[model samples]
Target: MVLDFGFLKTEMMGEIDACCDHGMMIWVDDPWIASFLPFTSREASAEVMQQYRAEVRETGQKLIEGPFGKTLLLSQVPTAENLAKHWFRRLAPRVRLRSGNRADLLSVVVWETPNCMATYHAPDLGRSRPGLSPRHSHSEKFPNEIGGIAGEGGNLGSHERSTFSQRF
Candidate 1:
């Protein structure tokens, strides 16, 4: 069902089969969709969870009509240390196992709010790049990209450090 559904019936079969065949349940939560699911019967609907898993398996092929549904691919698993900049809404976690099909074992846990993780984590406006932001990028690249007070010494210092030809 996961490999052949609507527009999802394509090369996605390989990825779906692989995950189903291996990639043992590493983590699971329901803060809203998965971790934050409600205690009510509606929120715990097996059908809803089944659909969610199918969409995750289908990934790029699946078309969903929700908030994060449009940007699902760009999201998920980041290599940077700035995951707190995004928001994830969990819906369902568990599903009903239909006959002749496999049931996946997923662990359910909640996420800790970034602010709650520390007593006094500093608020960062963020940099443009590693160890630097647009505000400071000029200092390292252009050096004298910005001008200083009447005679506080800005580009003058930058030029003094380098010859006219080198500055070019």
Candidate 2:
């Protein structure tokens, strides 16, 4: 799988807006133009804050300012300079092609979609191991499955156990 970023920028800023609407962590890379309140002035007076907000709306920029002076983050999609900077003349991957005596090699590909990232890895090259294979083996107790909250009816507290038992 391969993801092409070229098509994303042409949309109606929908991709960026969707990311923002979901409250996802957005970190603008270098060269993206954004205005950040200085550390000493992050907690501006109410009047100043209102002015800043007005300016942001007028310029179509986003502001990330918290109550504290130290926590201020500003991010905006870069257009002219940054876009030019991001351009790459050529993108080439080094791949080894089997010509003569070389054995077949496996390949892995990754694609980034709007909802999630997809990763595909070719099966092993006929090598067997004693332990489980990472590609096909998965534990129910993965990192994201904290407190036993994994599959349905998993890790329910004792209070709910009776209700779950009745349904089963």
Q: Give the top-scoring candidate (lDDT).
A: 2
Q: All candidates' lDDT scores?
A: 0.24, 0.26
lDDT of 1 by residue, 1-168 (tens): 221112212212333333323322211223344433322466565666666556655542222333322222223342122222211111011111221121111111112342322111112313211121223212234332111001112344422211110000
Off by over 4 Å in 1: 1-35, 42-44, 60-168
Candidate 2 residue runs with Cα over 4 Å from true position: 1-5, 9-43, 67-168
TM-score of 1: 0.20
- Give each model a TM-score: 0.20, 0.19
Q: What does the lDDT read for residue 3 in candidate 1?
A: 16
Least lDDT summed over 10 consecutive residues: which range in candidate 2? 87-96
lDDT of candidate 2 over 3-64, digit per residue (tens): 12232232213323332333422223323212333334435544565664566445433445
Error at 83, model 1, angstroms: 7.9
